[model samples]
Target: MPSTTPAPSDDQSPASRALADAVREIEHHVATAGWDAPVRVFALVRTQAALDAEPSLAAQLSPETLAAAQAQSWHLTSIEQEGLPQAPDLETLLAGLSWPATVDGVAVTAERVVLPPAAEAQMPSDPDEALPWLLAHPDRQDVRLAVGVLREGSTWCAVRTRANDSDDQVGQGPDVVPGLVSALRATLA
Candidate 1:
């Protein structure tokens, strides 16, 4: 079954919902470049806070964006982190990172090949050798995971399968990938 983002639950605070929105925006933006993409990262900042830091930015920001920021106390702007070093270990990359106070939160979008439980029996036990097996596994589902984390510990996750293939099919919630979520949270610590 395809995954889709549901309406925010009643318990979601405005800040949490805004983080979700930023995560969704990052997810959709990454999806536009297609699948099998590299690990893309972003820094989320409150829109008004950004403008406060640099009034000159007002000219660059659109009226609609400014309006949305004013409409809700939760609006955020996602700024992409370009030129990330190529690393085989995502956790390693994240471990070496830390965000400044100016950054309200951090987000990352990455693709993974998910294999069925039955297919796991044929996999190599060696972590180093698993990449080739995972790549060759025909029963695998290519899924992209977009995760965002706030310094206050709030988190949002979005997942989209290559099979489903659409923005509407994106599934979202908190901590979809627990391990990755933890790593992202550490960046804001």
Candidate 2:
């Protein structure tokens, strides 16, 4: 499906703008390449120091929150739906988010790929090792895959299709990516 860019008149927060831009870019790519599956999403996080380095976020913080200095801020930056192949690199994209220092949590929604039990059994137990193999697999072509990862190690993935009012497919837990999330977590670990 072709995804629409969030209108500029929508919420104008920095996060919303960033997400909108990402969606726009991804949708463009999908339009040309074909959106055989659903959209995928990933989360980005920033450290308190990283947020402090940005001037725009200064007004978003309070003296109390600044004094209490947390290790990380929880704001999500969306990656283009191309998964790992989107430009600027995931680490670089996350670093550029510039979220407010006061923020400390992020939530992500994404399309997911669920492997068949037999396919899952064939995957490597190690995430770092599995990632490359998974990316190169022919079977992956058959399913849509999206992943969301938090700095705190929490991860979720969506899979298949469910009826929804919107053009997008929404995925929930229990039916999402179990083995893939595990592998992704292992890579993070």
Candidate 3:
């Protein structure tokens, strides 16, 4: 005798659905604008006026954080670029960088390195110290990674840089880059 049960689907979860939607949105924007465009970054803002203008977004807003009368700002880097860093000069731009006071969050689509738990555990407490380790790690060779973060503690990342390249290679979820994301988040915190 055998039981009749359907296997779960990947997009069945709310989080999964959100990721799918976000990736699609980014892809559509890139396709419409052309592939050779430079990476663009936008500021995420939240305000009572915005909430009032779009009642639907009220559900997405953090009530506790928005209790004040002022507007809040966050940073979102476009993930539409064909590759990480976007421009040749981007590496120089990111070096020894300090975000502005108005930016409470950061979201970028640059290539990132996803480390194993053992590797993550070895990361230094200081981001400056950990940076060298991340750059020199043997596993980081020929890998593609992307990360996104929200000030409210929402983080997502993806990895797929091997021979088997496909749409699915751009995986996304909160489970990626706890250490690295935390380090980046700390900068803005």
Candidate 4:
């Protein structure tokens, strides 16, 4: 699905704008498949660079994807990673990853159950007991955190909560979810 991402402001750096577009695009892409989807990862690269590397991909992409990619000079193309290994947490999954030189950046989307600060204080201390507590929380919100980081350190995040779910409602900024941004940066480092 095409995203309704806004053009980054004039004050923003080129890297920041591109990463914002790429991350938001991935957020909408995953949203199209519905909620509760598995963690999805992607290798980000310049659209022209990717086409140069693999000409056959031109034939594989949909007409819209191809035209939009080629039309924008700074457009980023996301290559979704498949067969991801199971991991207990986002940190663990990312700690084991490293991208190749060809990849300009990376992006990942994961679903999380979020709650207000007050709700966290009532949670169980034990991991085993925490599952039920989290699941049964009355104020729980389902959120998708889509974070992207460039090898040069630019970052962008898109956050969507099920309660106010809509492409237009997705929040976008550099630190909307800082912890996830840092984790994504670690993978690039």
- TM values, all candidates: 0.92, 0.36, 0.41, 0.89
Model 3 lDDT per residue over 63-144, tens place? 6545542332221223222233434553443342345664434444344455677877888889889989887876653344
Q: Per-residue lDDT of 1-189 in model 2, one digit per residue for the tens?
A: 222222334444443333333333333333344345433333343425435567566466576544433521333333332334443443333333432323322322333344557777899989899878777766553434444434354444333332231235333332145655554444343
Q: What local distance difference test score does each model get?
A: 0.87, 0.41, 0.45, 0.85
> Residue-wise lDDT of candidate 4 within 21-117, one digit each (tens)?
7888899989999999888899998887788889998898788878877776567889999988789887899989988888889999999998789
> Which model, 1 or 2, shows the larger TM-score?
1
**Candidate 2 backbone collisions, by pair:** 74-104, 74-105, 112-158
lDDT of 1 by residue, 31-54 (tens): 999987888889999999898889
Residue ranges of candidate 4 with Cα displaced over 4 Å: 1-7, 62-73
Q: Highest TM-score, which number?
A: 1
